[model samples]
Target: MKWAGEPLRPQDAPALVSKGLMLADSAPRGVVYLSVPLDDWPEPADDTAQALLLQRAVDGSPVVTPQTVETLVTALDRASDPALVLGPGADTEQGFQAAIALAERARLPVWVAPSAPRCPFPTRHRCHQGLLPTDAGSLAKILARYDTVVCFGAPVFRYHAPSTEDFFQPGTAVYAVTDDPDEAARAPFGRMFVGDASDALVRVSDAVTASDRPWPAPLTIAEADTSGPHFTAEAILDAVDRGTRDDDTVFSLEWTSAEMFRDRLTITRARSLFYSAAGGLGWGLPAAIGLKLGRPDRPVVCLLGDGSPHYTIAGLWTAARHKVPVTFVVCTNGKYRALEEFAEALDVPKGEYLHIPDLGILDIARGYGLEVHRAETLADLTEYLKKGPDAKGPRLVEILQR
Candidate 1:
């Protein structure tokens, strides 16, 4: 939360609420709480209160100065190899388009930041270099080739596994553009520009000289083999990608095989993919329902791990009751694969509780009023997803991964 306030009197209620709304709608938007006493709710409003309630908050993003734009343009033009790294903040409509324009104009390879909640650039673009690794050593090795690195709306780095290596190699110049002051301050080494990233991207794109350098190699994914009796995570993700190849399809993902999903699926449109930045489980089911509610014209496909359904099983009931047309794909390996992987990464013994051999996910979904299907092969999964556009209500497809 960025702000919190309490109203002591009836007259203060309107002002506090108005201020809270403004702060919540501002840059780096977040939650704001305004508490009011129960007695103040029924009080009569004065002219001042009425005026405050009628006020509207306009866009307050700071304008990028000419000198700041020149500094960035010079940095990009002087460097032999420059790259752009984006985070969830660049997922907005304006920011998405601006980032693409800047990357194309400056001939910079674009990489999504680690733990990104949204896709900032077109996944199929020629200049895209895929996602950055979450570990410091691997991430540093990838960025070491670039002479200049400009990060937009992302921190200098975010790590997952423990590492003793430095985040950047020596002689690598770094710059950042973000709306959050705290993110700018927390950066280990970088010249920070605190403002709307979209504004800065636009200004820099206009002033920067077009580079004559060759574009990086396009990303490629090997085809998944499906000759086996049981489906693999790669096969399931490939089926989902092929089933929803339309531009209007949106994906909500919280499955364990996130790296596989990133490699297998092609997301060419901005805001087409959503994930939980904080690594929260059970976000897939509810997020799919809400995304469908907001974007009624787009088809929403939710991918979840088998163990994640237990965390928010009631979301199926809500979807069924509301007749939301979201296709829930639960990849069932009959265990919490993420937990086991984490334990292995930490070089610890696996816990006895890691195995979930008795969970009946399909039965629970059907009990909650959803139509359920058990898919044992890629053909079965593909057939089910083909009917997603005409689905009248919520449906769950369980893909058995043995």
Candidate 2:
């Protein structure tokens, strides 16, 4: 907890709770603790303090100063090649639109930061370069080409595997705008600006002049080979894309084939995609259920790996009990593909533990009161997804991988 306090008497209760709420709503939001004695609950409340608590407003985000905006505008205009990297915080409604405007006006290539939890920029936009590599060496190599790098809402970097290489070139100028002062202070290198990401982007976009530079080439996806009996990741994602409308569908991804999913699916709006930046297991199922509950007008589909469902299998019961219309597509590869990737990166020896065999995922879902289907072919997967969202209750689709 960032802040903690205890109420010694009943009169202190309102002030403690008010302080906790303010701290929780502040930037880099987090939990706050309030300890109340058991005896205090029986005492009469302070009427004035309770009235003030009810009238309190949420704390506002840190503001972006005019000078900070001017500095960023000048930096972007002076640099020959500058780029924008966005993180989950930039996925807010205002930040999403502001990022697009800033990138367009400044003629900068945009990349989603590694381990981003939300879709900060439209994937199909011409300026989008794709997701940055998580490792230091690869991430540095990509940013090395640019003279300036501006990170919005993201840390300097987030890495899954250990690397000995430096994060950036010596001469490359790096600037970061984030509301979290802790993240700003912890950055290895950058000129930091602590403020609301949306406000900063808007101010910078307004002050910067439009550039005549040409846009970057759009990312291309290789054609899926569906001639085989089993389905490829590409083929499965392609079927999902063909089966759902982009505006009405939201994707909750925790699968191993993230890069392939990015290539196949096009997310053009904020909150259309969700992932966990913490890289924790069991986030996909519950997150999808929550997304469906919050956005009843939009259909939610969660894509998971074979082993991911086991992490939060109970989420299926929650969806079933609520009759939430969520479609869970499990790609049964019979192994933890992500762990294999990490092992390869770290040069660890392969072991039997990596293989997940004979997991009755569909049976588990069925036991939780969810409708289940096994897709034997590309056609079967497409037909199932097309109708899955319209169901009154939750459903699961099991697709065997090649």
Candidate 3:
């Protein structure tokens, strides 16, 4: 009341809270701060305002210009090869369905944008390609293959490392359809259309004729051979893939070699695979615990690199306390492998600091009161993980990758 410069009116509380919620949920997502006096905490809100707020939350995308829509349609019609890049926005039910329909109709190769936390398009679909690289130059090269790139519900692109090169190659025509104008503004190159991604995709699908070209051959992801005794990231992931039922399981991956084998993993469904687009370490373990809490019936597995697990090792304590059914597979490569991989790119020396001391990760997991297993061999890792899908509580498997 003091903030609004009005007397404390109990009736105003519902509308105030609803307004704050609406602001926070609006396009180009951000936080909205609302101050409510303690005295007003228990007061009832106005019924009319509460209803209005609820209606606003369901507010659809703003009206789109027909000319902009026609421009996009014309561009796509002229393109010899056009691809769709579905971003975080496409993760929505409507947007996801529209994207898939458009891709299938156009016989387009669809790639998930880097910023997406969940896979929007069905990974099992023939048109669904794997994620685009986060490297600017690498992504540009991939996009270059398409005469026109139609990015939907996501930013133009996302990059982990800074690069001087432009986001798209010189000849490739780039277009983006998004609800967020900020996303369009931030894009380095593209003709951005401000509209609902799902609406845009649906309209484009209706306008465009089917391509004369045949559907691209589906990628053949070979199964990693875990016959060797030694445990490696690929082998561990392969075993995990083999042992777990894809539909009933969710994988939360950190920046690890297991992430490198994403294409080979059996995570075909949308939202089943989770990872940080920001490239932060230690989120995988804690995220797995959270996912387990959300989907109690599904098995949640965290594939963490040796270095990332340390970022949130304490998460295991919380998982144990709640008896959250999460299987943590720590890929122990004995060093900060990402740093080593980036040494040349970052122009840094590979030093002792990057090497983790023998901290006994199993002991750490045990200390957190988790059911722990140490797998020194591939067979041991596979055997332990075979029971992971049926596990009822927090379990940590330390994989020694030499």
Per-model tally of clashing residue pairs: 0, 0, 0
- Clash pairs for candidate 1: none
lDDT of 1 by residue, 1-402 (tens): 689999877988887877888888888787899888888888887887577568755656765578878988899999998999998877878888888888889889999998787888988888888888888888889999899998887877777767778877877798888888888888888898888887788788888998889987787766777765667788888888878888888889898655535747778777888988778788888999999999999999998888887789899999999999999998888777888888888888997788887688889999999999998778788889989999999999988775
**lDDT per residue (tens digit) for residues 230-290 in model 3:** 5656667767777674676788888465554576567555567787866778878888988
Could you tell which candidate, 1 or 3, scores higher by lDDT?
1
RMSD to native, candidate 1: 2.1
My TM-score estimates for the predictions, one after another, are 0.93, 0.92, 0.83
Please give the distance, in angstroms, between residue 125's alpha carbon in candidate 2 and its true position after superposition. 0.9
lDDT of 1: 0.84
Candidate 1 residue spans exceeding 4 A from truth = 9-11, 34-47, 56-59
Global fold similarity of model 3 (TM-score) = 0.83
Error of 1 at 140 (Å): 0.6
lDDT (tens digit, per residue) of candidate 2 on 1-402: 578999877889888988888888888776799999888988998898788779877746797688888888899999898999999878888889999999988888998898787778987788888888778988899999899999888888887667899877777899889988888899888899998887788788888989998876676678987864667888888887877755768999988655435647778788888887777888899999999889998989998888887888898999999999999999898888888887897899889999998999989999999999998888888888889666999999998876
Residue pairs in steric clash, candidate 2? none
- Which scores greater on lDDT, model 2 or model 3? 2
